[model samples]
Target: MSPPKSAQRLENKWDASRAKNMSEPEKLLYRSNLLGSDKRITNYGGGNTSAKVLQKDPLTGETVEVLWVKGSGGDVGSIAMDGFSTLYMDKLNALRGLYRGVEYEDEMVAYLPHCTFNLNPRAASIDTPLHAYVPARHVDHMHPDAIIAIAAARDSKALTQQIFGDTIGWLPWKKPGYELGLWLSDFCARNPDARGVVLESHGLFTWADDARDCYDLTLDIIQTAMDWFAEQTAGKDAFGGARHQSLPADQRRAAASRLMPAIRGMVSGQQHMVGHFTDSDAVLEFVNANEMERLAALGTSCPDHFLRTKIRPLVVDFDPAKPDIDATLAGLADAISDYREDYMAYYERCKHDDSPALRDPNAVVYLVPGVGMITFAKDKATARISGEFYVNAINVMRGADAVSEYRGLPEQEAFDIEYWLLEEAKLQRMPAPKSMAGRVALVTGGAGGIGSATAERYLREGACVMLADIDETALAETAENLSARYSADVVRTVTMNVTDEAAVVSACSNIAAEFGGVDILVSNAGIASSAPVEETTLDLWNRNMAILSTGYFLVSREAFKLFRVQDMGGAIVFVASKNGLAASPNASAYCTAKASEIHLARCLALEGAPMGVRVNVVNPDAVLKGSKIWQGEWLDQRAGTYGTDKDGLEAMYRDRSLLKRSVLPDDIAEAAYFLASDLSAKSTGNIINVDAGNVQAFTR
Candidate 1:
């Protein structure tokens, strides 16, 4: 059954004066009503709506007020005054200059300090700068499932150009932050009369002098796309010309409840509850269809929707007549695992440090053969909405395909938006390490000790790791051990001296050529010297710097170049010693080289920020096992200086830290994992002490 003609006309009305004449309170209600009119219209806090309210500035004796924007965490359909963040128009415009050339996420965070207005309960939208760029009094942004479905399809640009024509401007996907705002500003400046702007792989933005005009423009564009889609695929059926059968409501609800907790756990601590089925027959029928797999591969309508709907649809393979619900649940669990592994491989092929690793599926639409579609969400309303969005997207995509072909935005472009700064910043503020799946990492000096441990940790977190060291035997052995435990192709080992510039460059180039790109780099290779200042030879100092300081510089520079050229922001980890921070007696050359490496990382952090790169240092205190530095004259002299037996000296070093435990390679690797993942997206130019608490020892 189609929507009535009156309903369609009501949906299309562009009543600018109705909003212009309404009071602020009336306008808020109208906005909410408009937001709720379509379910696939918006998801969670995926959309933004705003109104400019003018008021008198008593202190300044002029007319200036707030531009009320949708606050973070507030759904547009249910937002109130508290959900809107009010920013001074003049101050927002003034902040534009601060955004230029700002590259690092932290630097952008620092710009918040320059704001003159009270930030209040709601933080300013990440799109605040874009909103400010618009001269319009009102603006609206939404990830309308229909619009995104059309945009995400293969050949989306052509489809969009065909449908949107000269009315909308398209901006390529970028890591959204100040750069995105600047891009939009430039576009708006050039096209003063554009109806709206669409950020590829992101969403849509529309603005006008009146709130109603802005909202209606959004509706008109979406409706046009919808109508165009319906016409194109009028005869094509999504169900693959298959018949559906009905399933019982009680059985569907039970299955949904069983699936909720597993999916919720995948998203960390997000609350998710099962919603009741409204179309039990449609769901049962779809699930029973033979072509369910083909239907599920259409991909999401928008990249961001993965946060709520996951990357692909969940195909429930179960017989409703079968009484073994537990067996069916087990089958679902296996399917999820298979899905996660497939996702991990996809991530490995295309993901960079800044990308979002796969999480669990959020909503599942079960298509029972004879029944309709049963969508499961945290609540009834959301479930119903998700179902409608999925169905509409599927229908349109199928139709668009029939017309010509549907091609999505480029894979790399989608990755940029998926790992965008706006979203990565939110993940960074969380407590635990974010997903590290699909990242390729290289650890220098990854033989027996600290390096091996670091490689193991990265492998555990789903990274394709390369272990490089001067010791060929140790490197091969460690690689084999890790591979045997984790399976083949999990770890790759290459023998090379970090001090050789050609060797470092070749190693980096080979990895990038082999794996497509390198996302994480750990510069852990180094040599140590223990002579006093006067006794230290120039030759010894030079050699120490070559391996410890210069080697790090060469490798990091290569990594930086690869990251920039590939357009995937990468992460570099320098494994410096605690001696870099605190002075140790009778080790001048070793201390100096370590200290130099630390400073090198800080400098790179600043330089790399513009290109979306992050650089950090890990200072581990006296790791004993697998360290070549622990052998030969260096170890004996250091032990003698401490006035203790070799074992006693090692114990003293371990006791120096606050944890009072020996530092291990695993500890440093865990720290490296955090730095490489989304956990450290906002962290750069920072020193992480993996030395337990050695710094506290000097203070005491």
Candidate 2:
């Protein structure tokens, strides 16, 4: 069947004036962005692009041809001109003559430096030579799902010929290296009419004299394959509908919360690990299918996915019909133990004498029939990426099965790629990770000024954050904004009232299950109350004590228990106030409650010291901006007390501080972050004043 006219959705958005003004490499960056912006073509950092350009040699001042390939680990969607590694085209091609097929992976690394055009070097991608040998002015490479679905099928060769005719050539599976590059060059030269080549169990490549042509050729081939796929699977329902479960969403969340901690304890070995849960409609539908175990055991649709999804996902058996949380957790714990044992055996079976040190022997992604999909990795971003890839893999596998039987790369082939030197080098070349990379943090009152600021700070440092607040609407909005910047799995929200002990326990349990366990606890939930001691109403005083005092105790108690169970050192930062340390007229209720909470942390620090827990305090004053605590009567009261309008209160407080700097929410958040991180590892029971400078509030 021919591709439909409407199947091609890509339109050339390149502005001629835009290209005319930019340099050759910048134009290539613009083109690469166009290609990567669509996830159907490539995801995250899975693809590469390059162009051949003329540049002057520094020594001879003569124009020379150079191949500018996308550097290793550079994401095409956000790459800059500097992201391209410049190599001497003539010198790089000379390696084709000296290639021996053996030890190609190792030799490729040793030879990369010599082939580059300059002394200041960047690591070129493993596919660099494949682009250099294409004999075109520009080239684009992508791992389009539609293309990989067809190529990874058992009858890939026959499918290629039938769908694309002679316009596309097919290459058999060979590990990417100098040998593969030479083979591609020879095959394309022999078939002059071939506009692209389909690499079996790999990806697709296209080349043309113009950058836009090469990019469009990629989209054209992908559309053709997708059109054929649509026809092949027209009415077949290979994946069935979901099964009705005994538990509802709320119950399932509760059960998952109870089970995740035990499972993480069983599998994390010595290092702390983070976990994420994803139950999107696509995932639940796939997991609930009758043949889910059989379908999932099949290898990934592409080898590149192995780096993220691993060779296969572990299927966890969960019968929602019998929803006993304790029994379910015990069962999951046993299964995780078995999975870890099997992973180690597999690693030992496939390892070579010179193989790199073995990573943690645990599955990165797990398939739970009732609870959706869960991904476990060293950090939040990697875990989220792993889940994303597995979600894509499920769709590709279904597509391949719909057309022909899904066949993936052999197990041995996957092992080779996982341990390849070039792949390892790519990981090593990544920039230093953030401080809280693998940690999980929880913030009380996360919808307010200080809580929101603290949550954002922890997220910026790469920690998985859970925002708990009584204001469900505000919490949802804050979560949406943060999710846009990072990912949904990285920033989550729970509608929790801190004063409710049962609700606090349940919310903390869910957080433990969702992210293994919490490492940092920021107890920042409190309400403001100011009245003369004699005139203070019982309701006003009790409200302050409920949220400010009892709330702190309940949340900290839950966190302390989890920390003790994990036997890992943890940090707790209490957002007290300078008002607690300094006496002010008509502020008895708030001052008393905060002072008690501050002392409670000191007691916890002493008790937790023997167990390696550190507890500290950040006392802030006059952070009026974005503070929900100062709304309604509290704002007017403070304004009247300061003899100014509401807007003037902030400036008046700033003037009173010795340093003349107004205390801000972020200022308090920075102090909290330092206490939560290793920067304050040696200090505990210490209060960091973020009031700019308050001599009266100083503690000796």
Q: Write one digit per residue (lDDT tens) for candidate 2, span 500-619.
A: 999999889878767978888999987997788998998888888888889999999999987776667799999999988997778899999999989999999998898789999999
**What local lDDT score does residue 455 receive in model 1, on the 0 to 100 scale?**
85
Tell me the deviation in Å of residue 669 in model 1.
49
- Strongest candidate by TM-score: 2
Residue 62 of model 2, lDDT score: 86
- Predicted model with the maximum lDDT: 2
Q: Score each candidate by Cα lDDT.
A: 0.66, 0.82
Give the distance in Å from residue 647's predicted Cα in candidate 2 to where it truly belongs. 9.5
In model 1, the Cα lDDT at residue 85 comes to: 70
